[model samples]
Target: MPLPEFNLYPDFNTVRLSHAYLNVSDLAASKAFYCDTLGLQITDESETHVYLRAMEERGHHCLVLQKSDAPGTVDAVGFKTYDEADLDRAEAWFQAQGRPTQWVIRPYQGRTLLTSDNLGIPLEFYHKMDRLPSIHQKYALYNGVKPLRIDHFNCFSPDVDASVAFYNSMGFRVTEYTEDEDSKRLWAAWMHRKGGVHDMAFTNGTGPRLHHVAFWVPTPLNIIDLLDLMATTGYVDNIERGPGRHGISNAFFLYVLDPDGHRIEIYCSDYQTVDPDLEPIKWDLTDPQRQTLWGAPAPKSWFEHGTRFTDAETRDSDIAASPIIAP
Candidate 1:
């Protein structure tokens, strides 16, 4: 099948990737890793839940860690609509597509619409999140990596082509994609609404698992600092992948497992993609440099292991190709 046409106009104006709702066994331990170590600030907290915001995010939170039986289960991935009217239209749009939709109450957010994509990945849409004062210049408050803001999410999908088409119909533009050399089918895709490289990405793998949530850092130097901190502070084993550049986005990255084993990437230095007519970059499945621009190949766990969504069933990708993996 051919690539889906990018929908420049849609029924609703969905804006950006906003937040993730995660389930963790220990709130305090997760708090130490996310706030004390990663530099996100506490927006709100209770015995059962905690909300976190990046230094540059004005919204009440970009992450929510809620107490659960264990770590590494995702509740939902969130995006913000352009306005309340858009949120209403988004609910209608999902309903019109035969996807279930519901209105739910969330703290500090207005009129949240809960639904799922074609892949059954849980998603939440809202507008009017409570705003907070910027703390970007509060240098003393900066911690481990000094993350500036939430950047994007990478999801493991059973069908990258279907995912690309589904999201494309929702007005996301494809920015980059990887295709299987033999089948010429999409193996992975990066789609954007807020116009960086991606607001979300889909990689060919098990169905509907979250690979990682990326945060924008000040520079590559911040990643170096995080490496040193994790090394001495008893989190050496948590350091999973690159302090290297990705061939796809040209992003400098470092992946670390939080206390709950959820992956988070501290990232920076990708170029802009704001122009409407920008062409999507493609990589072949067999390219040696497709996954990494430099440094060692990603470890096997990096591709195979990902956090499952609560109650979602897993499906293996129909089209598969071996990418370079560190043994």
Candidate 2:
């Protein structure tokens, strides 16, 4: 399929994938996994919610855990804007596109615009977040894998082409993409606002589900260290896949399931994508190395499973689309 016309979309001046909100059945267990096991620091906490940030983060939180009856569900995927006006622009932009939108006041965040993408994935946009002290140099506070910061989010969409076009209209540049060999239909796309390989990725799958939220580790060895920690901590079964390099982004990664089955990825070593004239890299869907540089295939669960997202206004699970993997 041809790419979307970039001129048709308004540029809302998005900064990056700043944070993600997740619903966990047990806040304590989720805290233990994220804070103790993953080495993220808790910024604030309550009975129902806990806010966390990475060691290198200055933002109040990069991840929020909200206590809920439903496990493995996402409340929303969030993005940062360049300024307060950008939030207003985003609100107007979503409304112009005929998508339902709401203004929300979140704790420790400035005015937020809540809306859904073309695929109905819940999204949050904000210009400011409360700042916290960075612990990047504090070795004493480090534990477990000690991830640096949030890198990106991978979401499943029934229609990759449509999702890509929607994101393209939002000023997200495609860095890489996968297409079916026989049909040449788009199977997946990696998009970015922060000039890395991707700030968000859309894969052809059952619709409107979160595949995984990735955090950047300092090095490849950190990925190995994380696997070791998981093995020693009696949470070895949660180690779902990898300590492998992806041919697409050139990122070394490991995917693990949290206590509530929310998938999180430990990632490192992706190249910068800041050049304006850089052409997006493309891959054939059938290429073995596309998924893993070393040729190991992703597990069925990795391809087939993802966490469902909740509607921002109704607070109910959004309807998911049927799976559509290419044969």
Q: What lDDT does candidate 2 reach at residue 301?
A: 90
Model 1 lDDT, full chain set: 0.91
lDDT of 2 at 140: 98
lDDT of 2 by residue, 6-41 (tens): 432455888899999999999999999999899899
What are the Cα lDDT values of the candidates? 0.91, 0.86
Q: Which stretches of candidate 1 lie over 4 Å from their true place?
A: none
lDDT of 1 by residue, 280-304 (tens): 9988777767788874688999988
Clash pairs, candidate 2, are none
Worst 10 residues of 2 by lDDT: 313-322
Each model's total of backbone clashes: 0, 0
